[model samples]
Target chain A: MIHLQNVEKVYQTKTIETVALNNINLEVGKSEFVSVMGPSGCGKSTMLNIMGLLDLPSDGKVMIDGQTFEAYSDKALAQFRNQTLGFIFQSYHLINDLSVIDNVELPLLYRNVNRKERKRLASEALEKVGLGNRMKHFPTQLSGGQKQRVAIARAIVGKPKIILADEPTGNLDSVMGNEVMDILLKLNEIDDTTIVMVTHDETMARKTHRLVRLFDGTQVN
Target chain B: MIRHLFLIIWNQKRRNFGLILEIFFSFLVLFAVLTFIIDKYNYYRQPLGFEYQNVWSIYQDTKGAPKEEVFATQEQIRNALKSFPEIIDFTFTNSNIPYGSSRSITSLKKGDKEIDADIFTVDEHFASTLGMSLSEGRWFNESDRAAGYKPVIINGVFKEEAFGDEPAAGQMVEDYNDNPLKIIGVVDQYKYRGEFVKPFAGFFQRVDTTFAVRSLLLHVRSNADAKFEERLNKRLDQIASNWSFEINYLDEMRKSTLRETKIPMLIFIIISAFLVFNVALGLFGVLWYNINKRKQEIGIRRAMGASKSGIGRQFVGEVLVISTLSLALGTFFAVQFPLLKVFSVQAGVYFLSIVVSAILIYLIAFTCSLYPSVQAAKLQPAVALHDE
Candidate 1:
């Protein structure tokens, strides 16, 4: 489960101050697949980042699995992110220098997993995403859809409970987008993994169990 | 983790080749400078083998005088100098004084080995005047000249080279024309040249009357100074006005001899320091630029789970690996010097240079990588990912 109470995000510059997310409260239950839909500059990604603990809210208490994380140190936050949450960026964010399997093994590396076990787990995760055959291929050598698939494998490799995807299918074709959506749906239904996705597509939003819309830094529905 | 770091370095080898080459050349130059430093240090620690304190040399122009006049002038000078209580001892010779420039080499054979020995022709009092210590036999004496074969006293280095494991004092080695010369005594060490030069085989023979004595070495008392030298010169002039002498203190010559190596050593250190500094700056610039270029990759790793310190460590580890690869190539060539005995320096000194250079390069690489690595560590994953 994820909880955000009185969440406020402000982006300040020398000339102006912009409120990315105004005082709002929201919660997503365990294993629930939720989509946040918004137009450009509507604070959809900012809300997702706060939920993922990648960025802190200007004023809010973030509670995940009955624990508050507002006072967590940077190291503790990173550890929580590694152990409890996984991320899939709009750009895939796969390291081009490493192969697909090696990219998947990144999170486990921080856990001090031995090399052989990391390799085994990485291979199994890639297989789960139907990317076992391309495990040795680099991100540069893959198509946009395959790269996103590799990113998904990386996110799920450590078996984090909460998966935060920010426009995961934004760079892919319709067929590849549906394929990725199907994987996320199956993970939510079968593995009981909680998912929060930020997207602009109506069809993608309709596929999720619930939709929370944002317009100009406030929750609309 | 180190293996993974190595793999990353390998993956980026093409981008890192220039850095590797820079470390390679820097390491090579560092090794050479270190070897020269160690070699000179070892040589400087050895004793000069004779006391140069209170000793001075006088070069006389006897070529203008007739043989009888030259002999008479030298005898007159000797007697006059002996009368001065400040003058402890004096010997007349054609050339070689400590820190004085004159060399004569002769080849002498011991069994099948032909040894080229530095020959110093001096009178019976030359050894005592120079304060040379003997390890085996006596200095040149009156009985040595009349003992049949020509008498020669060799230093320990020459004795070891010409007569290994055998008694050198009673042995005889043949000259180039196959004439036998008896080794009368074995001196400990006779370093006439600067300390950087290796000790060579030396043969000191008694100065014969047939040869003209062109120089005089005086062992003056501790209080001897310029006034005494001025008075002695004036007295020598009175004895033979046609003969002009140039006086030089042996102590000053000794200091100048050390200065000869020190100046070059300083220049070498400055030049080497400049070169290493340039390499360090280049390495820093390259690493900083490379880290900026890899921000996205770093961001991805950070998002996945790498800590800030982990990122910094990875960057530093990559530079260390590249430097290690470069050092490997540089050291391969360096090892050949000791193996081949190139430059005739001691092998231990060369080995020590290799170790010192390796440590120096590692330190340079680590220092150069530090700031860039910390910058890499401070990069925010979300901001970096968003930019990409």
Candidate 2:
């Protein structure tokens, strides 16, 4: 479901140039769960950002679902992201000012969903993540594990074909981390959703269908 | 979308309360200042109904002289004014002159419909001297002295207040003493107090022959200057040696009256401008701080599919919602001025002030939010996500 060919990403400043990702070629088929592992400063997040279309590659082609998006405008790209991709960040990234339900309904807000339909779908997503009872609470009121669940609900509320998780369980305890991993496994196995996760934990990386390692901006395996 | 925005603001009410209060106070100040300005402008645009250019008011202080002496001195001054070629016309009157501090107010009654009105006593030459035109009937003359009732001329506003749509000429109204007063003519308008004051219900009564006239109005030629004034004072001294004359140019009196009204308004405007500027600065700082605090939320929205313009719209729209709430409260209080009759201004002026104030507040909010929101929109989603 995701394709990258010779993708190279460079970070430049007035006096320095740093290559973030170098000559990377990777592919994940439909409904496949892939995990990327790397040490700090090894460009793991940079590769995920490029694949999630959050950052552009310095050189090479990025195609999603068999279509290249080099000519898409910012608005078109945003719309494509809305319709085709979901994101989960390490910090959960829940708006503290909004309630759990409102946080879950955020992605569908950019779509054409009406208020009632958005509420219904957000409620369903929360229920699936065991957060139905906490929908009225704010992100500040929830624990780290519950906040990540809310983020997952938000990510899956739009029913995107692909979910890009950047350290989804990084802030949680091992038990909570296992719970979140189980939710992702169920989503992949039951809904046939494609998943690409960036993690540092070997245990979590081994749970995925495949693992790709990066060292010093280049894929090692 | 508006509901969602309002929900967000509402959920953050504690954080936004101070901002709401600031906007509310700004709106109230703007409303008050705008109302005062618009009311004054409305009054200024009206016709004062009588000409003041090239005219002078002479206050003849007799210093408690005998009544006959006062009358004789005013008659001498009138005759002396007629002799000068620079003098177009002159009339003897009481102390109730236009823009003067003195006033004579009494109630007039017509068939149980009574209204309070200012009273002015002048001679037959008063209208000609002051360049006043009658809308109906004629100015007072010696023929009116032989009539059964005292002749009086009511202005159009007094006419409407007393008689509504009916004709006022030849109508008889009674004075406070129940003495019959005949309305011989109707002047369209006579705003005697000054340009910044509303016209009141008032009428002119013919001066009695036995009454002492302490003031004289002179219609002079356009070329009359300080030299002519010096010659007239000399002539006055020659005619009535004991009487002291205080000559005041009507145009100069008008300028002084306008200054009296405008100085306070100008000061108020300066103060209001400072207040609005400070509010604008506060709003800009708050929006900037809010954007800095919410970078991660902005990044999340961007990652969730909001366009850059969408983020900009959200920030700007949030400020507009806050302004809307504040103005709503401000308008609630502003309408009380007209409803409670707090000021003598018209209701329409208060409503117009509310509209203008709302527009100004929205403009301030929009301007203050624009730059900060644009900077927020320019944030790179990947970088913003990593922001603590």
The candidate maximizing lDDT is 2
Q: Would you list the C-alpha lDDT of every candidate in the order shown?
A: 0.88, 0.92
lDDT of 1 by residue, A20-131 (tens): 9997689999999999998999999989888887777899888997878867777777788899899998899887777888889989988889999999999999999999
Candidate 2 lDDT over residue span B53-81, tens digit each: 98899998887899887777677676777
TM-score of each: 0.95, 0.98
Docking class of 1: medium
- Residue-by-residue lDDT tens digits, candidate 1, B106-137: 88898899899898889988988989888888
Candidate 1 error regions (>4 Å): B64-69, B164-167
Worst 10-residue lDDT window for candidate 2 chain A reads: A65-74
The recovered share of true contacts, given per candidate in order, is: 0.47, 0.64
Interface RMSD per candidate (angstroms): 1.3, 0.8
Over the stretch A1-221, how does candidate 2's per-residue lDDT look in tens digits?
89999999999999999999999999989999999999989999999888878889999999998878889987888888888899998999999999999999999999979999999999999999999999999999999999999999999999999999999999999999999999999999999999999998999999999999999999999
Docking class of 2: medium
